[model samples]
Structure formats: C-alpha cells, structure tokens
Target: SVCHANSIRAEQAETFVADRLKEIVQLPEVLPRLVAALNEEIVRQSQPLEQELVVLLERKEELKTKIEKWEAALEDSPELFPMLKDRLDELTEKRRQLHIRENEILGIFQQGEPIQVKDVQRILTSLDRFLAQSEKKQIKALYRTFIEKITFDPNHKEM
Candidate 1:
C-alpha cells in the first residue's frame, strides 16, 4: 500500500500548507504587501514586453520611411526599379513581421489586469473556501496559482 501511503502523505502536506497560508492571509498587512508584490511582479515581467514593443514600433517606422523613399525613387526613375524592388520588398516584409509581433505583445497586455487589493482578498477568500472542500484538483490548482515552486526534501521528509 505504498501508493496509498504516499497519497495520504501528500494530502496531509497540502492541508498543512493550506492551513499555514490561511493563517498568514488573515493578517491586516498581508493583503497590501501581497498586492504590492504581485504588482511589482507584473511590472517586472511586462518591462521586456514593453521595451520590445517600443523597439518594434520604432523600427517599423524606420522601415516605413525607407520603404517610402525606395518607392518614390522607383517611381522617379524606372531604370532603377529592378534594383530597388528587392530591398523594398525586404523592408516591407520586415515591417509586416514587426507589426505581427507588436500585436501579439499588445494582446498579452490586454489580457492581463493590474493586480489589486480586492483581487488578493478575493483569492484569499477562495483559498479559504476551497481548502475546506474535498476536491483535490481544485486544491492543487489553487496552490499552483499562488505557489511558483515547491521544494521537497525527501531525505528529511520535509516540504
């Protein structure tokens, strides 16, 4: 019955962690601090996306300018059209790719909401309620939502 024993141990550990979390979340200062940390994490994570979007926009603009100039030159001199067409096509394709990436980043930003105190409270409340339920799937999902990693030391039987 090793599997059954292991399952029992896992349930016990989850319940212990849930109890600890519930106790910690009840404190007056914890909500604000949790919200601040979540917000900080959101900003920290978004910085690269924001920077990349900016760079993409700028590069797209530069490519637009270059493309316009090439089109104008091609129009002004039909003799050079064959030579300029390849570079113009390249700039257009690059711009198109940048636009696609910019939209993807924007989509991600649009999907995320800024974390607020009430959001944390609501989550804590859900945790409180869900922990009382007997569903392991929900409990595990809730844990995953808040816990980034869990380090278990089997030698010492510690989590």
Candidate 2:
C-alpha cells in the first residue's frame, strides 16, 4: 500500500511538472523577439569593448616601438644605460597592462552563439511529445536533463 501510494504521488508529480513545462514552452511566438533583443543587447554591450580593444592594441604597438628604441639606445649609450633601462621597464609594464586589458575586453565579447528560434521550436515540440508519452523512468530522466531541483510548497500543494 505504501509503495502504491508513493507510485501514485510520483505519477502526479510527473504530470504536474510536464504540464507546467508544456505551458511554458508555448513561447514560439515570443521567442524570436526575445532572442533578437538578447542578441542586440549583447552586440551593443560588446561594441564599446571592441573599440577599446582596438585602441589597446594600437597603444601596445606604440609601447613596443618605444621599448625597441630604448633597447637599441641602451646598447649604444652605455653612459645613459640606467635611464634607458628605466624607460624600457616602464614601457614594458605599460605593454603588459595593455595586454591584460585587451584580454579582459575580449573575454567580455566571448558570448555563446545566439539561439535560433526554429531550433528551439523543434526541441519544444519534441519535449511536448516526450512528456505526453514518457514512462516514469523516462520522465525522471527528462527532469534530470532539464532541472537541477524542484521545490514544493506544502501549504499550497504545489511545486
């Protein structure tokens, strides 16, 4: 009796989750606009970083030129070697800083490829069919694939 009751409760839970998911996946109409907005936002945010990376790369090249000049003069003007070395060190540090900043900006630009609406609709349709016909084990596996946890409110008898 205990096992039967537990089995019935599990079935009910599976139905509840599947029904909720089906309701949520009815977003084929809105998904395109939502995806476009997300992509536009990403591009807008990354545009500044892209421009800054270009500037940093240009500055890095300038620093490299100065460091090269210092290195060349350091060999020829031993008398001013100390001053030349100091300048070279400063230029090298500036170049390093530019490199670090370039990397940071590039990281910000490294967003994942945008999701296509058709792919999402296809997957949602498949999921709807799966949920409609899945056995308990298959339902559990489906839940595991898409969900991390499910919290229920006892007072409301809802998850």
Candidate 3:
C-alpha cells in the first residue's frame, strides 16, 4: 500500500513539474538556476511524503510481528490473553486507518487534473501587465529580437 501511495505521489509531482516547465516558456529570461530551483522544490515536497510512507509500512510490519508473538504467549493464559488480544485489535485498527488514509491520498493524487485554462490566462495576464509597464524602447527592442529569429517563406503572404 505504501508503495502504491509513493507511486501515485511521484506521478502527481511529475505532472506539477511538467506544468511549471510549460509556464516557463512565457518568461523572457530563461535562467538555468531558476529551473533547477523549481525542480528541487518538486523533489523536496515529494521526498518527505515518500519517506513517511516507508516509515508507516515498517511500523505496521513491526506491530504485526509483536501481535503474533503476543497471541502465541496468550495460549497459555486465557485471562491474560484477552487483554493482549484487545491491544492487538487496537493496533490493527490503527494500521487499518493508516492504510485507508494512504489510499485516499493516493487516489486524490491520481485523480488530479492539470491546471485549467483560466489559471494560465491569469498568469499570462499578469505577465502582460508587467511587460507593458516596462519602457517602450526596451519592449520594442525585445520584440524586434524575437521577430528577427523567424524566417518567412517568400511564397507566403508578407506581413
């Protein structure tokens, strides 16, 4: 179950990374350091969740082993055995709850969709506003540089 949860979380994290990379296309300056920073953040957020799942699975296994030992010892004392059984039942319940939560979180991760068009439009609008506020000469130079990068086919209608 932990393995499954980790897998789902990884997928969600990758999707987030891809979305961010796509958004980077709009930025005028493509800083390698900024790209690396974003990648680091994605890994940082996902790694802790993966570690937590590993710990949960290990603890669950340990609890199961302890419960088995207690059960075996209880066969000798019927009265003492019931108390041990109750404790085991409590531990089992806790494990069950953990499993349910893990599965739910995993399901949410798997079901998550990419950011909507509205979100992209909002981001682009913000960027446009920022660019508009810059000096006209600078903006024109930037625009000309971008325009000069393309080669128009002579057969096509001239702009």
Candidate 4:
C-alpha cells in the first residue's frame, strides 16, 4: 500500500485530498463546491473533539466557581484556609492543564499554513504536468509533505 494510491478503494481519499487541496489553494472555478465539501468533512471529523472541548470548558468554569467560593471563605477562617488554599492550587493547575488539553484538541481542527516557499512551489507544481526530474521530485516531495496515510482494515478488507 506504500505506492501511488491509484487503486479503486483509494478513490475516495484521493478525491477528498485533491479536492481539498484545490479548494484551499483557491482554484477559482472549483472553489465553492470543493470548499463546502471540505468544510463538511472537517466539521464531521471535528464534532467529537469539539464536544469533548465543550465538556472540558464547562468543567473549567465549575472549577473557577468552586475556587472563588474557597477564596471568599478564606476571610472567615484563617486557620482552615491553608487546606482550602492547597485545594485551590490543585484545582487551578487542573484547570490550566485542561485548558491546554482543550487547545491541543482545537489545534487538530486548525488549517496549517506552509512555512516554506518551496512547499508552495511544490504545491503549485503538483497541480500541473511536469516532465523534468526536478519538477517530478518537487511533486513527490509535495505528496509526502501532506503525509498521505491510508488505514487498512484487515477484517473488512477496506481502507
């Protein structure tokens, strides 16, 4: 399976990737349709992660409210406040960690920008036919840059 994904089963991934590439790079004629399709796919893939993030955010808010109550109660009992202080610190750290995890989950849904000019050139070159070895290399590198990974299901014989 470590070859050009030219097989019938790979058609879906190929079409999805190619159409998404076209849409992202803004090929005007195919723009709207492909972009909408990619957006739908993105939303579908991100939904579960998004839900998890929402839950985490709600927990964070709950923790914040609890910490505020602890801080307010600190004025009433300086003797008992150390225990509450420690709990507050623990909850604050947990909330911070949760926020970081939420951001990491959200990062999965982000659109990546090419950091190099050559990557852009590679993308543009891949959109056209090229006979030269240099151009071929560029196209090959471009394909790898996207890290086209295919998953195979042995039980069902599908990808």
Residues 2-111 of candidate 3: C-alpha lDDT, one tens digit per residue: 11432334334333433444556456354344545655666666666777777877887887787777777777677896568778788778878778767765665565
23-117, model 2: which lDDT tens digit per residue? Answer: 65785556677668877887787778878888889989999988888888877887898666767777899899999998877776665467677
lDDT of 1 by residue, 62-121 (tens): 999999888888888989988887898899999999999999999999987878788778
| TM-scores vs. true structure, each candidate | 0.74, 0.56, 0.42, 0.53
- Output the number of the lDDT-best candidate: 1
| Candidate 1 positional error at 152, Å | 5.5
TM-score of model number 2: 0.56
Better of 1 and 4 by TM-score: 1
Count of backbone clashes for each model?
0, 0, 0, 0
Weakest ten-residue segment in model 2 by summed lDDT: 1-10
Q: Select the stronger candidate by lDDT from 1 and 2.
A: 1
Off by over 4 Å in 1: 1-8, 110-112, 136-148, 152-159
Clashing pairs in model 3? none
Instruction: Decide which is better by TM-score, 2 or 3.
Output: 2
Q: Candidate 2 lDDT (Cα, whole model)?
A: 0.74
lDDT of 4 by residue, 1-159 (tens): 343444435445544555556554555555445546656776787778889988999999998898788877887787887677789899889989998998899678675322343455465456633323446456456656665575544455433
What is the lDDT ranking, best to worst? Answer: 1, 2, 4, 3
RMSD of each: 3.9, 6.4, 17.1, 8.0
Q: Sort every candidate by TM-score, greatest first.
A: 1, 2, 4, 3
Clashes of 3: 0
